[model samples]
Target chain A: MPKFLIWIAALAALIALPHGLSFSQQEILVFLTINVLLVASYRLLTLTGEWSLGHVVIMGVGAYSSALLTKKLGVYVPVSMLLGGVIAALIAVLLSFPLFRMKGFYFLIGSFAAGEIIRLLWKRFRDPFGGAKGIKGIDPMPDFSVGFYQFDFFEPTSYYYFAGVVVAVCLWILWRIEKSPVGLTFHAVHWQDKLAQASGVNVRAYRTLAFAIASGFAGISGALLAHYVGTINPNAFDIDLMVFVLTWAIVGGTATFYGPILGCVVLTVINEVVLRELGLEQMRPLIYGAIMILSILFLPNGLESIVQKLTKRRAAGGAPERSPAE
Target chain B: MLDLLAQTGLNAVYAASYISLVAVGLVLIFGVMGVINFAHGELFMAGAYAIVALYAGLNVPFFLAVAAGLLFVGCLGLLMEKALFRPLKDNPLGGLVASIGFLMILQALAVMGFGVRMVHIPPVTQEVIAFSEKVRLPVARLYVIIAAIVLLSALWYFLKRTKFGWALRASAQDPEAAALQGISITQTARIAMFIGAGLAGIAGALTAPLVSVNPHMGHSVIVTAFIVIIVGGVGSLEGAIVASVAYALVHTFVTTFWDGVLADIVGLSLMLLVLIVKPTGLFGSADRA
Candidate 1:
């Protein structure tokens, strides 16, 4: 019943991931892992009330930077991954200097613009990143070495488990941050920045750190995706992905830790499992649209809250109205 | 150089038309509902695909099909409000998340209904308006330009003259005050969604034959719409139009002169420039942020 149980269960799910899934289906679910990791990371930054529309752009920066460095400059994959995260963090921190002056929605808009700039730069450097065609066949992800258990990087189930593990690790790191004093500062900023500042919290410092940390994890997701697919396309890093992740985090319930996992898993499974099976072909969006509408209509608290209510109702006949305190 | 400039100018006109239509709808929704409709581009895509189904597949009259596309997508927006945004009224973030979910649903539906391939929305005209031998504008492009002018003007007139339009604006500017005066938030949101979505739909239907009509086509427009809204200043209807033209001109000219890759750079740089100088956007007032 601990959070660690969820991580263990996810790891078990990954081990059996490919039992029935086709190569393509496994591919989509793996992509969902990437989405889950990034969405959770995105929710981390959103805790401080710094909503970002350009996080996917940060992901692209990570993906392309690691990709191009390894492919062209002959850098090692692990080092390249580290470099990607570091660069993204540096960029976010530097950009936050001027952007931190703006409060509320203005900061959000500024970040969106910054993301567009990143996308443009990637496309502009066609020779390096393969432009629209994107860099093809980056160095394969090195085999993860653990004592005597060597996991092959080429297997679908292996990568699925790898993605699962990474997501779980990221989730734990995010959980740690949420429980840390920094988390309190972030929630304070989100709730009331003026009050937080009056209480001597360095609002700007915590805000920048939150945004940078999210970007760093996004970089990891991007790097993993690039290495997993062995191909990188500019299209994959487009603004639409950011919007999708934002939706996942929100619908999952940004206020709760488990919201994104539910948003990514449940919605994705529906999108894939139902939409694909019905072969509603192109018409599957109606089902998705209907679900979103209904989710918001009947349960504005998002899917996470729905899960909470269902679980609570089973435990007791009625649910309380207040948030359970930390 | 003259011919190249001429071509870029014509390109700007077409870009401006479509961008303005999409941006205006975005502005209208933002103004009234106080929620940024992330699915605005998908609504636009739905409009184009509507044309693909009715006009191209079912052989409906082109103009009537276009109108149907507008009305249908507009209804979809209204449904979104009643079903999604209305219940999450106090939570803008929830509305946003709902929209994100809505986008996936729309994209999936398009894939089911139309398949993933680009549907052929028959060209309205093959004629070209020649500015010179080396430079000409397609009649289809002109249609877009004309549509932008007429639709935007009609919107302005309605806002300036009509009772309902005033009611809509009043609700947008101050919902609580409007509520005090007996103007229903639900009614105003419905009106805003209809017009906002109708504009995006019509834009899609009109440009269907001109651009590739695929399930993912909304992706670019949404980003472009965001950039335009940001540059124009979010929640400002007039700001959207002016910024759209400015963005289109800059985007088209760069695209024409260099490559799309470079043009994107210049466009982002322009957005960044605006952010540094006027964080509220060119026309956006300080309070909206």
Candidate 2:
């Protein structure tokens, strides 16, 4: 019952959170929400024990697909977003054919090479991709009314609420997937591929499944950003951003589901609010790099490990009286 | 048309020289240490910046600046090994992530120190070796080519002929057995990191006058090096050289006839093909990586 109340309270806080922020902070909140999904999806891929440098490009695939589908084919904004995710998943599946042939460091390099080729293709083909400038004037989600609230697409607060709900649903689905047997198979493949294969688990298929699903969610995040920003270029999803995502995952520690999310939120707050206020924006990358290294060296288990330790201590101390009787 | 082909060939040779230099260093580091040094391209950039500061800013002689660049970047490598790689020796991925952090630090420092614009160094020389009206190679490019040949030959002789070379090779092949045989992993690692980083630094310094010198210039160089090392086979110095030459030929011709983007596309696609056909690379055995 207490856990249920905590969930309700958390939901209430999320719903009320954006109202207190300034205009730019609300905007940052919306991006932070989308990035939460991006990093979470990235964690799903990492569960299979292969870290890819191409994930942001896969996200770009989603953004591009969503943008093009709405502009050229006249698809509805919401529908195009779903299609964007589906296309990104399909592309991941296709890439897996060549990419899955290698493992470890080779996989990392191959994926990077594959992503660069995709980006270059977008650069070379100006017809639909808009060359280097990328697709602009992207269609925004049409404003609509719900019974309790009106969603004005122009307002960051409204967009935040809408994206928040969408992201919550996506996170629920990801959580459920992680808890399922499929997720267990992903763990198995990661830890002991040979053993998993020997147990008739088809390791390659699970790896492909994880990659596809992760790309699908990443695509959705990209679509959300595309509709909100109304513009994107190949540079928007370059290696610099990819490194940021990688750092989030690493610094957050990928052992638990919420680690990367925590890493993303904390880093975003540090990057956006704290740094911006202090007027150290130019030193953001340098400071960020230092943070990444320090975290890796000192907190190898991530911020969640601290959370875990605290929770364990609370459980031990608080439950000591009833433990023997129980 | 024949003259154009010859000119393209010369360009390919120059490209091959610098690229092989970078790729070989990458290979050497990967071989000796079981970690991929993602900061390698940044190390190359540091070398170029050394020349930028010393040769261009302080008016040092070009050759003296090149030597300084090599030694300085080599020292940077040693710092990485001691500070980052050594502690995370057991976890290759952690080492890689740390190197990436190092890469960002280097890039940020470059940006802060030099600002974002491309830095122009006065050309080392105005002379060009003319084979024909269309076929010519600049003196600066000649210096890079000569340096690559001499340094690589020296590296080859050192690796094949010296006691330290055997120790490095043995450790690369089997760290556990090498340790059992009384080889100092730390010492070998230090040597490998220094030479590997120095090689990349020298390549960057030599080619600084010929190419655009910017903080982010390392990106394309690293990409080219990755393609070459993968095509040649990871951990194989000989394979890196062979693959570099082949890649440069194909890329140079494609850029000459078509466009630079297409040339990149081709180079990447060729790497993918090699990866698909032979993941161990053309010359590498399956056990190394």
Query: Which of the numbered candidates is closest to the native, going by highest lDDT?
Result: 2
The segments of candidate 1 whose C-alpha lies over 4 angstroms from its true place after superposition are: A1-33, A72-74, A144-148, A160-168, A273-284, A310-326, B53-61, B287-289
Highest DockQ: which candidate?
1
What TM-score does candidate 2 get on C-alpha atoms? 0.96
lDDT of 2 by residue, B121-214 (tens): 9999999989888899998999999999999999999999999999999999999999999999999999999999999999999988878899
Least lDDT summed over 10 consecutive residues: which range in candidate 1 chain B? B280-289
What are the per-residue Cα lDDT tens digits for candidate 2 across A1-326?
A: 99999999998999888888899999999999999999999999998899999999999999999999999999999999999999999999999999999888889989998998999899889998998899999999999999989999999999998889889999999999988999989988888799999999988899999999999999999999999999989889988898889888888878888989999999999989998989986687788778878877787777877877789886765322111000
Error of 2 at A313 (Å): 1.1
Model 2 off-target regions past 4 Å? A316-326
Query: CAPRI band of model 1?
Result: medium
lDDT of 1 by residue, B1-289 (tens): 9998888888998898999999999888888887878789999999999889898889998889999999999999998888777777777766776787788888887877778898777777899989888899998889889999999999999998998998998888789998999998889899999999999999999999899999889988987888898898877878899988888998888777687867777777777777777888888876443
Fraction of native Cα-Cα interface contacts (under 8 Å, chains A and B) also present in model 2: 0.50
lDDT of 1 by residue, A75-154 (tens): 99878987887777788888887677776566677777777777667666777767678888789878876876577888
For candidate 1, the per-residue lDDT at B262 reads: 78
